[model samples]
Target chain A: MIKNKTGRIFEIIFYPLVSILIFLIIWDVGVKNSELSVVMPGPWEVVSKFIQSFAVPIGKYTMVYHILYSLMRVVPAYIVGSLAGIILGILMGWYPVINRILRPLYELIRPIPPIAWIPISIVWFGIGEGSKWFLIFLAAFVPITLNAYAGATTVDETLIKCSKMLGASDGQVFKTVVLPYSVPHIFTGLQVGLSTSWATVVAAEMIRSTEGVGWIIISSMDTNNVVQSLVGIMGIGVVGFILAIVMRKIEEVLCRWNRIET
Target chain B: MEQDRNLDIILKCENVSKKFQTKHRTKEVIGNINLEVRKNEFVVLFGPGQCGKTTMLNILSGLEKTTTGKVFLNDREVVEPGPDRGVVFQSISLYPWLTVMGNVEYGPKVRGINKKVRKEKAEYYIELVGLKGFENSYPNQISGGMKQRVGIARAYCNEPDVLFMDEPFSALDAQTRYLMQEEIMRIWEKEKRTVIFVTNNIEEALYLADRIILFTNCPTQIKKEYVIDLPRPRDYTSDDFLKLREEITENMAHTL
Candidate 1:
């Protein structure tokens, strides 16, 4: 097992590095021959810009500032929206009356894209962080709710019967059986929600915020600093990748008993 | 066999019937079935597929409600499922999220037993089932026969008045099933709870049961009852065992 794990780790590290090296060689050769460097900066230019931005620290306006600002808006909204969505979804799926009363409303609102609510959000809460937060909330909410509902509804009936036979009350059964069983699906939803939140954050920040990774890209685009814009874009991808890795680690720790299929 | 008849009745089913209504039709599954399980008795209900043996066992365990008649546990009418009747299903029904010890302790915890007491009870049963060192092992980490052992230990830990087994060893491989049968017999000998075992295996019924109740096909009714007079550690190759097996098989064939 140890030997296999070591071989796996070696493959994981070497495979990605080899791919990146090949891609960089192709990119550098292409940039030397064409005029595409003005529009799409090569990897070296983006890395240089990123390092220069890091070297300079201003008043809440560095690369770190934009990253933190984007995170602040996305994190709270993601938490609130996903948590509420999960709880409501479980209720809607578990009880007939709740499903009857809430399902139609959800179906109606879900079809309207989160971006479509931008105008209403601006009017209702103005062009401040509130509108951006609402957008992030909407982006995160729908998938979490749908996945949670599906997870709760599809719990194995035999497990519920077993729980009841063991003297678990209705609430206890829901807590122990329904909730835990739905976790893998719920985590799937959360991963989707997290990525969506990051995707939508750029749009939200561009629409309203004075500072964020999205704003940095827009400002760099306005000034025709394409390399800085590319830096901003790559930063977003890196942050998203980190978040995904963190979530996966958490899932592993919490669901140690669940056998993951390769 | 004599001791079983002499002991007080722990469970009684009086004219129990179960019917199910589907979208298109209503059908009776069991009809006017009556049974009594004396304390420490191992009674086997034997029949073929769709014989309502499972339905009857479910009704007795309060998992399925009887359309008519009643089930009594220690003279108290059973209306809902409770820990008083522990059930082992054909499938290994151990909670996937819980470890072997956790699965065993689930019943006691739900019944509001203290943590220490529940842990002790769970540990005792885990050891009883010869899974002493695998306390923290999850259900998925174990083999099929081991998982079934965990299920058996979990049910036994509750110390139920009557243990209801619904073809518990049917899913096991032939060799594992035979080994499990011996394990069950050993456990029964030691613990001596009233057990109502349901199976389609006639040889199994003959081997384990003090009394065997044979049922007819769908909308099942008890066709005959046989008192197994075989002694402990019954040899399957013995003349008396084979004779009983042949008689039961013939009876079942004739009913079919």
Candidate 2:
């Protein structure tokens, strides 16, 4: 078993390297032949620009500054939004009165895109970090809430009865039985929320921000420095990838029982 | 025989009936049944499918309400499920996310027992059920039989006045079921608690019970009650055992 696990890990590590190498080769070749302007520089150019910017001062349109700015807005919004979503979702799912009172309002609001909230957010909070934070929160909240509600509502009745038979009170059963059982579904919501938060950060920054990766990309566009803009985009992808990997690792650790074959 | 009268009554069901109302019709599951389980006695209820055996057990455990009549636990009315009557369900209902120890400790914890005492109680029951080494293992990490052991241990840890088993071993394979019956018998001998076991298997009923209550099909009523006079460590091949099995089987065959 130990040997099999080791072999699996080795395969996982090597397979990604092979794929990345193939992707890079294709990208390099395609960029060399394409008539697309320097505005859309190739993968290699973006990498070199990323390295060159890092050689300069820390806050001078560098990869670190833009990435940190984006993270600052996205992380807090994601945390607050997801926490609210989970609490509300569990309540809505567990109590019929809450579900009946809140579900229609949720449905009405959920259809409005997070980006579409820009004008209202700007009017409410002005074009500062708050507007961007609100957009990111809006993006992360709906899916997490909906998924959590579905998870909590569908808990097995047999399990609940089993808990009661063993002398668990309603509160005890909800805490030890229902909550833990709904974790996989909650984690699924978190994964969606995390990814969507990242997707919305750029749009949020594009609408209202002055110092995030999205703002940096916009400034690069104004200056017609396509390579820098491409570097910013690549940096966003890499950061998102890293965040996803971290979330997956946490998911595996917390939900070892729910593991399934890929 | 005189000692039978000395035995305390742990559970009593007086004219218990259950009617489930569905959208289409109100079907009576159990019709006016009277039963009693004496303290430390291993009582088994046997019947074929849809015979309301499970419904009776559910009423005993306070998982379902009786449409008529009353159930008394140690002379008090059974209004809701409590730790005084621990139940081992047919489906191994150990909490999936909790480790074996966590599941075992759940009862005591909910009963307002302190952490140290609950842990000790859980540990004792874990060892009692022969699952000492797998305390930290989650439900999915264990086999079906092992999971059932955890379920049994969890119920036993609560130290209930009566242990209500709803076909606890019926889901297991034949060999495992037989082994679990012996295990349960051993545990019962040591614990000396009243047990109300429900099953559909005739052999299982014969093998385990001091008294076997057989039930008829839908709107189930007790058809016959047999007081087994067989000695302990009963041999299945013995003439007396065969004759008793035949009697019970013949009695059950006519129920449909």
Candidate 3:
């Protein structure tokens, strides 16, 4: 059993490493042989440059600062948007009157993509951190609200009845049963919301930012530096992967009971 | 005897009838029926599968409303669900997010009982239902029979005036079903709360019930009543038990 577990772990690490090496080798050879090499640098050059950017500044700040600035915008907006969505969505799902009142207005806002609001957000909040935060907020808010609503509405009927039978008042039932049941669902919304907001941060920063992964790509485009553009994309990919893993770990902790051990 | 019966009656229903109205038709689920349950009596409502037995139990427990008629518990009309009446659902609806102790203590917890008091009450019932070591286990972590045990403990811990068990063991395997039957009997003997158990299983009805009320198919009404005087822990293979089972099965078959 011990040997098998070790073997499985080795297989997990070995296969992914092999796949990434193979991908990099193919890209390097392909770019060396192609006419596209003039515009696109080799994978080795892009990767080493991305690594070196951590210690050496790309423009005014290092890659670390670029990543931090992007995170600064995404984190606060995502947290606020998620909190608002969970509250509003759960209320809409639970109470018919709340749903009726908010649904029409929500539907109108939901269809407009966060990127579409870029021009108006710039007009309202100006070319500042406010406009960037607004765009990321919309991205996170939309998916989280829908998911939280789904969670609240889909609670088991028998469980609700059981709670009532157990002498729980209407409010008690909502707090104890409805809220706890919706948690797994809320986490699902959070996962989607987090990714959506992180993705939107690039567009949000496009409004006007000095140090961000988005600015690196936008600045690279002006200088026609393909290597820097690749570095920025790589930064986005690594951070997004880390964020998803962190969200999943938190969900596993909070929703331990939801996991059925077969 | 008649005066004592009237005085002992803890739950009574009068002219109970229910009809569900949809767009196309109004379907009668329960026809006119009346029942009187004496305190500490184990009354089983036995019928064919998919009959209105569960519906009857729901109406009596005040989980659902009757189209016409009234249900009285301790001389008070039961219009809505309350702590005085507990229900053990067929689905074994333990709060999935809550642990065994949490589910059991939920009744008192919601009713404003202190954490210490409710916890103590919950522990006693948990031990009573043979789930002492499983207090921390979630519903998904437990087996079906264990989940049902949690359901029973949850209802019992509430200290309701009566408990309505709607096909609680109908989902178990044959061996588990028999084991649960004996466990339920032992639990009932110790606690002796007024119980209204519903089941389509005839042998189970004979085994558990002091008084068995047989119900007909949908639009269900009382077809017959059996007063089983068998001794405690009656043997399933005993001549008396088999004889009673056969008699009841034949009588119930006629209702179809």
Candidate 4:
């Protein structure tokens, strides 16, 4: 049994590493043999240059500074938007009158993509940090609210009945039963919202920003620096991957009871 | 003596009936049901599967509204669900997020009982139901029988005037069902709360009930009542126990 457990663990790590190795090899071979090499550098060149940019400044600041700048915009806006959305969503879901009042307006606003708001947001908040924050907020707000609302609305009827039988009033039931029940659904929304916010931050940075991963890609086009653009793409990819893993870990901790261990 | 017996009644429901009117048709679920339960009496409502026994329990416990009737608890009319009456559901609806202690203490906590008092009450009931060391375990972490034990503890912690258990052990396997039957009997004997247990199993009814009210299929009403006078911890294979079981089963077969 111990041997089988070790074998399973080994298979998990070893196969993924092998798949990555194969992917890099295929990219290298494809680049060396084709005209695509002229425009797109090999994986080795891109990776080395990406690493070197951490030490050497690409334009005004290093690669790490670019990532830090992007994070500064995404994190605060995402937090505020998520908090507001959760409150509104749960309220809308729980109270039919609130839902009836706000639902039509919310539905109208929900479908218009965050990027579509760029022109108006720039007009409303200007080409400053305010505009960028506004865009990311919209991106985070939509999914989180929808999920939290769904969570509240879909709470098991039997659970509510049980709580009432146990002597919970309306407010107490909302706090104890409705809120905890909505947590897993809210977490799902947070995951989707985080990815959307990260994606939106890049797009938001594209509008008159100096140092960010998005700025790196947009600015590289003028100089025709393919390596720099690729480095920026790698930065976004690596950071986004790390963020998703961190979010999942937080969810696992908060929702420990939801899982069946066996 | 009649006045004393009337005063002894913990719960009484009069002329209770229920009807469900959906878009398609009006279906009658429960025909008239009248019952008076004395203090600490173990009354089992026995019937065939899906025979509106659960609905009848719901009405008596104030979880559902009756089409025509009134339910009185301690001479007070029951209009809605409150902590004064507790129900142990067949589904074993323990809050998945809460620990066993949390689920047990939830009733008192919401009713504004202090933390120390509620915790003490919860702990006492938890130990009574044999879930002492598992105070911190969530519902998902426990076995099915263990979860039902938590359900019972949660109900008992509320100190309701009467406890209604709706097919509480029917979900368990045969061995666990028997074990839970014994556990329930032991708990009832110790606590001596007025209990109205609903089940379809004759052996279970025979084992636990002081009296069994047999119910007919939907448009359900009381078909018969058996006064189970068998001694405590009665044997399933004993001649008297088997004889009573056969007679009840035969009576129930006619209703179908």
- The alpha-carbon deviation from the true structure for residue B204 of candidate 1, after best TM-score superposition, in angstroms, is 2.1
C-alpha lDDT (0 to 100) for residue B217 of candidate 4: 87
Residue-pair clash count for candidate 1: 0
Winner on TM-score between 1 and 2 is: 1
Of candidate 3 chain B, the 10-residue stretch with the lowest lDDT total is: B1-10
Candidate 1 pairs with clashing backbones:
none
Candidate 4: interface RMSD in Å?
A: 1.1
TM-score of candidate 1 relative to the true fold: 0.95
Q: Which stretches of candidate 1 lie over 4 Å from their true place?
A: A1-5, A30-38, A56-60, A260-262, B4-6
For residues A1-262, what per-residue lDDT tens digits would candidate 2 score against the true structure? 2458778988989899899989988888887888753435677767777777666532354667778889999999999999989988888998899999999999998898899999999999888889988999988898899988988998988788877776778998888777888788998999999999998988898875567677767777678877767767777788899999999999999988677321
Error of 1 at A240 (Å): 0.3
Which regions of candidate 2 are displaced past 4 Å? A4-9, A33-40, A56-60, A223-225, A260-262, B1-6
Q: Local error of candidate 2 at B27, Å?
A: 0.9
Kindly list the interface RMSD, in angstroms, of each predicted candidate in the order they appear. 2.3, 2.9, 1.0, 1.1
Clashing pairs in 4: none
Pairs in clash, predicted candidate 2: none
Task: Judge candidate 4 at residue B69 and give its lDDT.
Answer: 89
- lDDT score of residue A143 within candidate 3: 88
Top DockQ model: 3
Whole-model Cα lDDT per candidate? 0.87, 0.85, 0.92, 0.92
DockQ (0 to 1) for model 1: 0.57
Better of 1 and 3 by DockQ: 3
